[model samples]
Target: MNRSDMNNMAGSPYLLWRVGSLGLLAVVACVLAIRSFSPTARTRQGLMLAWAVAVVAIAASAFVVPEGVSDRALLNRIDPASGVKCATSIFVLSLPIVALLGALMGRAAPTQPRLSALASGIAAGACGAFVFAFCCPFNDPLYVVVWYSVGCAAVAGAARWRLPRRFRL
Candidate 1:
């Protein structure tokens, strides 16, 4: 998004709804991730639960913003890129977070290191999407679903792949 394009959206009337929805999902994802890391709780909850939460969070965040609240013009402006830029931005925003979550989970060394790392990644990805909500003005459900999901998935996948190695035993 260009500076002026961003400036133009300063008063965008629909931001509140998008941010609120994304924020709530982010919180849920974070909670699940944190819980999944607990050594005592690792067995009780595992990869399936982590994935379930991420899927639910994705569906809700995508559909939360209603259709009538915003016009198609904004999306038209962004439609050319097909949200690739947004995905990149979201990934960039979440990278530091992913690294931190990985380090924490690695240190904890839960019984299920792989699962915990995957959960950490999912949570970090959700948070990254949440952080990008401020800069993203497009309320298009399709746009949100496709690009945001990609961005979040990228982070989560990275964490999952790397964190399992922390467990030597």
Candidate 2:
């Protein structure tokens, strides 16, 4: 985005928090997944920790709506079709990252590659949805809950479905 656009967005405290929180979770998830899937092969505990952190972060993001917008405006933003579209696009965009991470985590647990795949998917999905905070102009908390949070989950689900087959070793 342009400098002016960024400045405008930055003016909104809620938007900043929304992006920052999700971004933090995404980074943490990826870090933990990488650690667990590394050559040294950390335990599943790291992956579980990452999943817990991501869940909490997503839950918290539900409250980070843009502060100045009116309730009417917020309500108007609650179109289910648009939310679904937005979420689907986000999930589609994140697939490559999820797949790449899954491949990198190849055979982390020979008997349970699914765990690594799941972690990689969650990381990629969270990061992908976090980017939507920049593009989405709506400051509706409900919007964030439906589109951003659920979108990340959809990405994770999609990744779980696709990654195992693609990354099978």
Model 2 is weakest, by summed lDDT over 10 consecutive residues, at 66-75
lDDT of 1 by residue, 38-156 (tens): 76765435456555655665566544555564455665634648588888888889888788877777666477777777778777887888888876767566577678888888887
Backbone steric clashes in candidate 1, count: 0
Q: Which window of 10 residues has the lowest lDDT sum in candidate 1?
A: 9-18
Q: Which of the numbered candidates is closest to the native, going by highest TM-score?
A: 2
Candidate 1 lDDT (Cα, whole model)? 0.70
Badly placed stretches (over 4 Å) of model 1 are 1-14, 42-82
